[model samples]
Target: MIDLTKDGDLWTVTLNRPDKANALTEAMLEKLVDIAQDASAARCLVLTGAGRVFSAGADLDAARAGLATSDLWERLSSAIADLPCLTISALNGSLAGGAFGMALACDLRICARHARFFYPVMKLGFLPQPSDPQRLRDLIGPARTKMILMGGEKIDADTALAWGLVDRVVPQDQLRGTVDELSADTLSASPTHATAIKAMI
Candidate 1:
């Protein structure tokens, strides 16, 4: 399930199925894609999860049904990357599987202290979404990216922060506040100004 909350020019999209470790179904992934595509109108957009784990990636049943290799993952990540608004991935916990695409697409990423990061595609015998490797490489570099993708290393939050996989590692209780603080300037700036700045980068 997904929860979208809008406050003026800020849009927060949350994965709400904590019971499933926020694992995504095809319908849920489609909803996220639709939301990201529609989020261009906002000044800032935040992606996060409701529980301790951001996402365990696609739901087990869904993955077994061919969702693991679906092109929707690429479509969703592309939409997020193309958004004119400033985008942040406020990772509440561990990030894994197909969920990595959206997080890697974000302009900024901040994760909770307990969060772990991994994409076990190699171990699971699936290739990652098309854009994920380059996006991830852009953040943390090729060898390090391979350490996760090819070597199957599950990186902890501290290592993620140190390697540039995430921008900050904050306490779980402060995650939303941290996102709000980071978004303040973008939220207050004129849409044109913010968009232009993002474009210039």
Candidate 2:
């Protein structure tokens, strides 16, 4: 499930199905796409999850049903990347599989200390969403990207931060507050101003 919360100029989209480790279904992916498309009006948009795992990627049954290789993953991440706003992935816990696209697309990623990052597409016998490899490479470089995508390495939050995959590693208790603090300036800025600065970057 995807839950969207709008607060003034900030919009936060959360993965809400903790029971399944927030494993995504096609419908959930579609909702994320819709929300990202509509979030252009917000000055800041945050992507996060409801529980201990940010997402385990596609639901097992859904993956078996072809959701693992769907174009929707590309569409969703592309929409988020195209948004003319500051986008942050507030990773609550471990991030894996297809879910890597959204985090890779974000302007910044802040994760809890215990969070881990991995993408097992290579091991899973599916190519990653088209843009994911390049986005990930841009952040952490090709060799390190290969370490995860090819070597199937599960990186800890500190390693992710060191590699530039995540911008910050905060205590879980301070996660929301850190996001709020990071969002404050953009939230108060004129949308046009924020968009302009983002474009310049």
Candidate 3:
């Protein structure tokens, strides 16, 4: 469900189950959390997906078999949020369901120009972890969060940028290069300043 790779200063964690829309299983979630928690030396931590969809969030089918979605989600999101270095959600494609929380927990989110950001919890008849809505609120605002979680508005890359949901958008072909540049720029700050600024922010 996930693949992790490290090259010098860059660490990337990718959701690999493209055929499954990158839906996260409990085990997958645990692994992701572990990766984030252990990423101290990396200058940049990137979360992305392998195929056309970034991640669908919790695996509903697994949940039917008793996967603890709320608990696992809380752990994973919290781990990402606490990463000391720059954390970027590199959305290669659409993001949906609980995956929105994953993206929001990152310090920055950059997406493909055509990618969509969807929240269908209300339509699916269940709310995500209690803290998820708040994370979304922190990124955008409570009002906009309500519009998505309650009012049922759909968001594309453009809309997400306008609402401050995503930090940048690039053509699909240029996404990797864009993220590479940004990662370099983020790491360009002096180590002390980077850590201090990150802490202060």
Candidate 4:
């Protein structure tokens, strides 16, 4: 359900289930953890969706089938968040539910102008993964965190950029070039400095 490509020190991991809007399954999250462990040599790691819809969130079916999808997802997000290299979430399309945590876990988020963002835990009556609220607060502050967690607010790309949920928003066609430029700018630093700053932050 995912594809990994490496060019020099850049590693790109794409969620490949376009037909399912890239909805994350337990298997996908497991693969993510494995790839993340192997990405130590990468200068940067980019996470994105294949066709569109970065991810619709955790696969409900898998959860219903007794898979500990949320636990696995939490582990995957933590693994990515702790990566030594610069990390980016290229939101080529909208992100929702657990996907929001994935994007938030990234050091920087570059989103498509039309890409949307939201978390529906309130609406679904489900408690989020243990660390999600703290992660949300870290990105957008406590008040905004309440707005999303309590109010179930849905934010579009422009609003996401303005609200500190994303670092940049680009039109669909410019999404790739924008991410590439940012990646190149980040990678220009010496590896020592790059990994140091990543850990410092």
Candidate 5:
């Protein structure tokens, strides 16, 4: 589940399954896609998860049910990656498995100091489809991505920031404020200018 709140030109999307550490479900992915579509009119977007984690990744039950290949999840991932607004993933806690894809899809990532990053799909006997390999390489370069994916190691927030996987790392309490300030800064730009600059990148 997810909740969407709007404040002026900013949109905040919160993953709302704290009981399960916000493990992503197929329905949740569908709603995420819908929210991203609606965010087209906003100047900035912020994504965060409820409770202690940004997300633990895919719901194991759903994954076991073969829902990973659902069209909804694919569409949601693509939509988030292509969102026109400046999108930021507020990594307030650990991000694992498919959740890494969600954060990587964002234009920028702001993480809490205590956060950890991992992609355990291979350990789960599954490979990330939909071109996650290239996205990981683009975010952190091939060598680092290979180390993380192949080694199946969990990296702390500092290491992730150093590797360019996260744009900023701050205290847990500062996460939301940091995202708010960054979103304001992003929204200050002309939409055309922002779009053009992003296109060039």
Candidate 6:
């Protein structure tokens, strides 16, 4: 359910299961972890999805089927957080649940104008994993993160940008071009310098 392609020094990873709104499965997360680990050789890495979502988060059916193990979640989160290349989430559509964690793990995010961000675990009588709370606080401050987690409020692209959940918003049609431009800029930097800066942050 994932596709990887290289263009010059940039690596693009696309979530390919549009039929399910790109909801992530255990297998998909495993592949994602592998790709993130391997992307170190690329100057930049872009994460996006096909069709209407960057990802809808975990596949509910798979999760209910006991396919999402705690060990696997930890491995996937660590792999994303420790990625060596400059990583960008090209949020081409709305995201929810565990997908928000993936976006949070990225070094930066460029979201589409129509995209919405939400984490509704509270409604499901569950809490997000530990990394999600910490990452959300680090990205958007504790107060806002608390509101998101506690209140279960969904934020639109503009509000997400204003609240620092996303770095920028682009028109849907411009998402690919915008990501290409940003990745090209990232590729223009010295790999060592870029890696150092990302590590420092």
Scored against the true structure, residue 14 in model 1 reaches a CA lDDT of 93
Query: How much does candidate 2 score in TM-score?
Result: 0.98
What lDDT does model 6 reach?
Answer: 0.84
What does the lDDT read for residue 189 in candidate 6?
85
Per-residue error for 10 in candidate 6, Å, reads: 0.7
In candidate 1, what are the lDDT values of residues 1-201, reduced to their tens digit? 799999998899999999999999999999999999999888889999998999999999999999999999999999999999999999999999999999999999999999998899999999999899998898889999999999999999999999999999999999999999999999888889889999999
Best-matching candidate per lDDT: 1
Model 5 ranges with Cα > 4 A deviation = none
Per-prediction tally of clashes: 0, 0, 0, 0, 0, 1
Better of 2 and 5 by lDDT: 2
For each candidate, give its TM-score against the true structure.
0.99, 0.98, 0.93, 0.94, 0.94, 0.93
Model 5 per-residue lDDT at 59 = 93
**How does model 5 score by TM-score?**
0.94
lDDT, model 5, position 179: 86
The residue-by-residue lDDT of candidate 4 on 1-201, one tens digit each, is 899998888899999999998988878988988988787788999999987689988787975674433577677778888888988999999998877777778889998888978888888777777778998898789999998888988888888888888998888788778878988966788999888877776
lDDT of each: 0.94, 0.93, 0.83, 0.84, 0.84, 0.84
Q: Write model 3 residue lDDT over 13-51, tens digit each, in one string.
A: 999999988998888988987897898777789998987
Report the Cα lDDT for candidate 3. 0.83
Candidate 4 lDDT score at position 51: 78
Which regions of candidate 4 are displaced past 4 Å? Answer: 67-69
lDDT of 6 by residue, 34-147 (tens): 888887788888889998788887798887776443456666667777887877899999988877777788888999999998888788666687688999998889999988
